[model samples]
Target: METNTEPQLPYMPGLAGVPAAESKVCDIDGQKGILFYRGYPIEELAEKSTFEETSYMLLYGQLPTKEQLDGFTHELVHHRRLKYKLIDLMKTLPETGHPMDALAAAVGALGMFYPHINVMDAAQRHGACVRLIAKLPTIVAAFHRMRRGDRDVLPNDKLNHAANFLYMLNEQEPDPFHAKILDTCLVLHAEHSMNASTFSARVTGSSLADSYAVVASAVGTLSGPLHGGANEDVLDMLQEIGTVENVIPWLDKAQAAKRKIPGFGHREYKVKDPRAKILQRLAEQLFARYGSTPLYDIAVKLESVMEERVGSKGIYPNVDFYSGLVYQKLGIPMDLFTPVFAIARVSGWLAHWMEQLENNRIFRPSQVYVGAPPRSYTSIDRR
Candidate 1:
């Protein structure tokens, strides 16, 4: 008999409240419904900063000076175009495939082009960061247009990051109001403290994998319904409710049936998610700009009803709750909701990816075995 020598440690289901790595990238105070990136409040960043600048802060760990911002923005703008081969690759994917699937594959392939990516080289790391944050939106928008049998639009250098993405997706410049709202959405979503996808990114990056592989893994994690896909589900839920009047009855039925409602609860946030509050405001502003949709009305009613019923339970509307309403009003297709989330989140993933490399350690968490104990093997003919 072999003697057991491994240390016994308590097993936590899903690694809840486990600290995996130290990071200075982002922080969340779920109790207070506050989020900060590099010590700056998310609300301030969303209101006063551009996605480009916010992305810069997340990656570099500080606000950029005007000159620094210009250089960084220049790099992002210049790197926005994907190689033609990548576009051709997207053409081969089935139109029915999920956007996230296509995005993951394309990003993985994108890494293949940079086969010599040296994580140890600071210059190379900076290039990789710039290229990824620059190109993700182009990848998402290009595939979207291609799947619809429309020609892909080239990056418009004249536009800012958020506006340029909206331009590529729609083949026309978006209204300033729409672009500003979307920029705020991106800032809100750019980073969250150690989320599921960010954890996946860190895990993969800890293996010293290339940036693309790290991000691709994170994209795959985000595709799950409980994570980035919740915004899409929120839209589906809103459509199913059909009208504002149906909100309370639907909640009553869903609650009584014990069916989980999408977009209402967050694991990190005990109070109403701060991002959800901002997004709700953006939804209202968007409604005012483009005329209201039935979905927003229903969402409003649903929030009120949910508050009356479940607010005391620390289950409240999270970021996903109102984001879909805002995106829908912007004319983004429901399925692309998660892909857009990926575009914004790539910054956070890359930031964490770089941080993981700084103090790289392969994750090797111990798991308690709960299966049958070792049994002696018998010869085939003998029981």
Candidate 2:
């Protein structure tokens, strides 16, 4: 037998622009700043859909009917309670631990409690998906309260998903306007096709890993600053700018030093991100209700300065730009920003995991070997 010895193809750094899989889950037209899920425009979904409804659409591939949604919501609400052992495990984590770390650990622990599900079975997968969607916010809220030495605020079944999370975190019922804002945020963050974390989920699922393990891999991936953590960086940058007047000078210095502006650019959208557009409008409404924060003013000015400097180069405000500011106004701490992203994005992660199982193939791309090849073996003292 003879092996083919053809030269390897040129390497593409980061596998940019590669088509790893075919998905009906979501689509993005980067140039036009358009995003869609199941062939429906993002704008329409953000305007009309609740996070629960959007989560259903992502997981099941269609918007649920009123009856279906009611049943699904009931299931989610009931499953919000975590096993006591999971809460005990979260307590052992250092208070300084990042929320994403606690979340990944807790999600991985879920497999131990719910061990009977068969990953290959569709019904079992759906059950796991619902549990994860229901429980993540509760886990996040538990860790948040424990870290602050506050008494744990259990989930409120009477409220919707977004509102319940706020109630648990704040230990007070969320105002209707605040709850609605957070719900829209969740809908916007629910899914994006083949993003870093979603790709991580699919890769783990391709190995036939269980749903908990698949989501754990994604949580770890999302912990990276370049992914889900970018919003935290954006908020920090806005605070450092300090005032609207500092925006122009700060942009100049940052550009001169070749420093990156956290939220001013995105790899996918050449124009403003569609989610950012929606969030910007939400920010306006929030400021009107809660009174404007200084950070929001700085963020707006920063965007204007960034546009003048780099707008022609296809750099613009991304989802992270306004999302952090919105979360700040909602009384969320900066560190918890990425964990909130995880809560919303778990729907998408599970969707990709299920999709990967439907057409399972192990991802094994070859690498171009540039190091010494076919070297002769040498004895230790040969030289």
Best by lDDT: 2
lDDT of each: 0.90, 0.91
lDDT per residue as tens, model 1, 166-214: 9999999999988999999999889997889999999998888888899
Residue-by-residue lDDT tens digits, candidate 2, 205-267: 898889999999999999998888778888889889898898888888998999989987877
RMSD of each: 1.2, 1.5
TM-score of each: 0.98, 0.97
Clashing pairs in 2: none
How close to the true structure is residue 158 of candidate 2, measured as C-alpha lDDT? Answer: 96
TM-score of 2: 0.97
lDDT accuracy of residue 16 in candidate 1: 90
